[model samples]
Target: MPQITMSAPMSKFSSFNVHDDFVYKNVDGVAIKTAILVPKSLKPGKKAPVLVHMHGGGFMTGNRLFEPWFALWFMQWAESVGAVIVSPDHRLLPESSSEDMADDIVDFWSWVHTDLSAEVSRVTSGATQVDLENIAVGGESAGQYSFRAQLSITNHEIGGFLSVLSALTCPNAKIKAVVCQYGPLDYEVPWFTQPNHQRSIMGAPPAEPGKPEAVIQDYLTRYVDVEKIAVRTESRVEELWPLCVAYAHAGKLAEALGRSDKVMPMRLIEKAESLPPIWFVHGSGDTIVNPDCTMNFVNKVKKLLPQTPMHVSMEPGEHGFDGGVPLDEKWVQDGLSQTAAMSSKPGEQFEVRQTSTTEDYTPDPSKSLPLSPERQALVDDILALYSCQPTIRRVERYTADCVYDDQFVYANDRYKMAGQWFALPKFFKESKNERYEIIKNDRDLIQFKNEQSWTFKLIPKTATINAIVSLSLDPDTVDSDFIQVKYHKDQANDKDYSHNGFGFQFKKFQADNVVKLMSSDEVKYFEKDKHAAKEPVKKYGTGDETGQAPKQDF
Candidate 1:
């Protein structure tokens, strides 16, 4: 990514001055750039509320800077609410997974109010004073999930990112309000089955093997290298971008099934007691992200938490309706006034309006199970492989084979001999640093992560893969017994995205100690400072050459 620069305190509009990359904060070993907008009418030394907006791009593309449309919208919002607006350039996928991005957002939130408020005031030379107590967080599309994550599971420590700031640091600190615009709150909803829907919860097309291009199906489960696995796009996403996206949603789905600590806002409808007042805006004609997702979430919140101030407004338009529609200053001012009145008081009035009911919908469970615990577990485990910190370190680093299922059926059965599958594994053993324990069974989750590292071997080289499973499991799967596992890998060279993960199941399972499951040679390999013996690269032949590849039925 190129460095984006802008003049400090430059006037972008008549009502406010914009400052880009005000103070870069290190989040999860990655620096997060933030932009601040201060209203021109605000007097120095007088504290004003702040609105933090998380930009949306399906977690694949987007930034914090204001676009042309956002500029006018921000100008109106600031003038109406009498607040300063801050946007953080949260990290994106392929390089940083959703879990990593969530960590950055949480850290950004904690730092802004807990650490950067004073700096912000001093840097502006007291021109703008931020009222940390009245901070509000909002987002659209993928960005909305970040707010949901923070609200529902912020107190729980999940990954290494928690080392800097635990969600419990300021338990009493609460978000004043939220603005959700056309967000995808439910993954299991039939909203994806609509005629114009571009993507399902699993993700958009080209994710399915052979949908547009013929690919080695198992590769989707094994490794994430786009060089080894080709997508239909010519973009910069060389690493397994699609898998990263699918896995992130999977983790949320698992959390929704009550099988993980990850938070999915729609799943927390019954636990809306702690949520802040919210104003939801959606387009009745929007098909990009089902407007019904937001409605469903709001309706559930209204039913479960009647005291929580809530409002919903729908217009006749498509996704990103605001971008095309010109903003009316009077309407924005009135809306903000109503928001303020409702914030100070509770449930004064609720609003819901729409031009058409054609797009209004509720998901049907007959088409699919509302939630699949097994698939969710697989996704949660994959995410953990990328985000979880090791509880114990037995060595500095090592490359070893940790296999999941040797005879793993590829659902598509692309290969005749299933035992020939393999993936590369590089383990970086680091010392335990912080006391971050958000999930009680996180150790078990980590164990699954280790096993997922093994499943990466099953993928075929230079082939894209996609897998969607419908099997469900008990939410109490955390206590399931472990099974024997083996691993095979080439030498390690600090490669992180080399291992892609897949979902698999063992028919006969039994519990075994970690020490007993790992061979002494493998443990010795971990302790070795020098590179271990180089394993000969395995040769793979096409179906025409060896007649081992499964026939393409589709």
Candidate 2:
């Protein structure tokens, strides 16, 4: 019922033609989409630069057009810079985790490069075009981490997202500038970890008789397990705001994001070799997310990219104070100017180009190492098994008594294997990238790697199964050479991510010691072998965050 269709809250940008629900990609069969605003002046042949923005809903709830939190200045920037606007809705939390968000980011940028142009042209009847080569990213409150900042609260708090972006190998597209609204950038600070009884912007923290912690559990059960895309997530702030307040009140904002050392995200400032131009907007009177979030992040980023344009639009207001300010206001004009300047001359060394020469690239499964028809057929069947394709029954992929084992899943016989595979849909939304890089090929042996993405329906998050698998075929059974999957003396695993190969066995042992310290009663409740219960390995924040009960600042 919570659909994020376009609503024109800002009247100034009415000149631009808007298109909603451009399906960029699909995750777990759910369509992840973006809302686009193309300037009417953007001619069909002449490419216009692009700006992709993330919306803010305190992270707990808000759709893409959650107009209440829209950064009004984004419109000015689009007009001044002559950029087409693309706003996307990503998986949101208390129900979702930082790991799922990371995938969304990767897939988003991947979509921007591969499919954005065609989508734009199709929507506009080829009257509008997007310049992926010239691009910028910005976001408000929860959106800040989507662009820059150490994400902490309701919280599009994309904890340590910049590090992920920096590691990506996207050479074709250039990240021109970063616009950050009043984002809760530093989660490591006390303001984030401590309870704020006083109202800042969102609303007054929940008063007594409201057990937010308990309410969180009820809402978790009441709401959709995981709203894959933000807009599709029907968010009634009235109902969910308590969970946001409670999360902060209990100093559990850190817990909601999982444990990550990067909540502060200053490591990026210390090690980043080169960064694009950045701008900041924060109100001095801000309380919910202290002004320090912007000042601290800007200060650190300024030090890292001192020559780069590190513009700030500081003023006197609270979080999201300028959402509806008129464009004629001096402060509003000043803020808009700062962003426009960044968009124009993005960096001291960066070149401002309206076009790009690099060819667009999208992932191709067929581009992997080539194999003869027989070898390829064997590889295809093996992948079907990895993806747990139910229709692979007649494919003769796995033996009836195949030894399939994993940390949380155990399926040896075909019956148990089928049950485990079938239960996957029940427990998690499954998506697979069958891209494989064959490592070895022989008369009876084949090895390759496959990464399977899972969004757990119950736990409401994601996990990637990167299984480097090797299958041995009985040379004597030439007919089933490719179809035969056998257990090797040391190469068989039911675990998607190998404990033996990836050094998780040590962590498992360490976890075992901690489990040993727990009382019998506590141990009884913890499910050691349920994939739903297992913590994802890559979720952001410091794992060292200690758990505690509520401590109201009131």
In model 1, which runs have C-alpha deviations exceeding 4 angstroms? 1-15, 22-29, 66-71, 140-171, 192-223, 226-261, 324-334, 346-554
- Candidate 1 lowest-lDDT run of ten: 152-161
- Write down the worst ten-residue block by lDDT for model 2: 346-355
CA-only RMSD, every prediction: 30.0, 26.3
> Relative to the true structure, how large is the alpha-carbon lDDT of every model?
0.38, 0.51
Error of 2 at 227 (Å): 16
Q: Residues 1-554, candidate 2: write the lDDT tens digits.
A: 00012333435447578788877677667787778888765544646778777766656665555444445555654653457888777777755665565567667778888889898889888876777657777775232211123322334323213322323223334776676666666665677676544433343534454365566667666654554423233265455555666766655666676654433345545666666666676778765667776677777767766756566778886566665553446555444434434344211111111111212222234545567665677667656644545442322343433334334432333333444444444455665653656655765566555556666666767776554445554321223223444332112132123223234454444333443343333222222111211112222121111111111110
- Evaluate residue 51 in candidate 2 and report its C-alpha lDDT on the 0 to 100 scale: 77
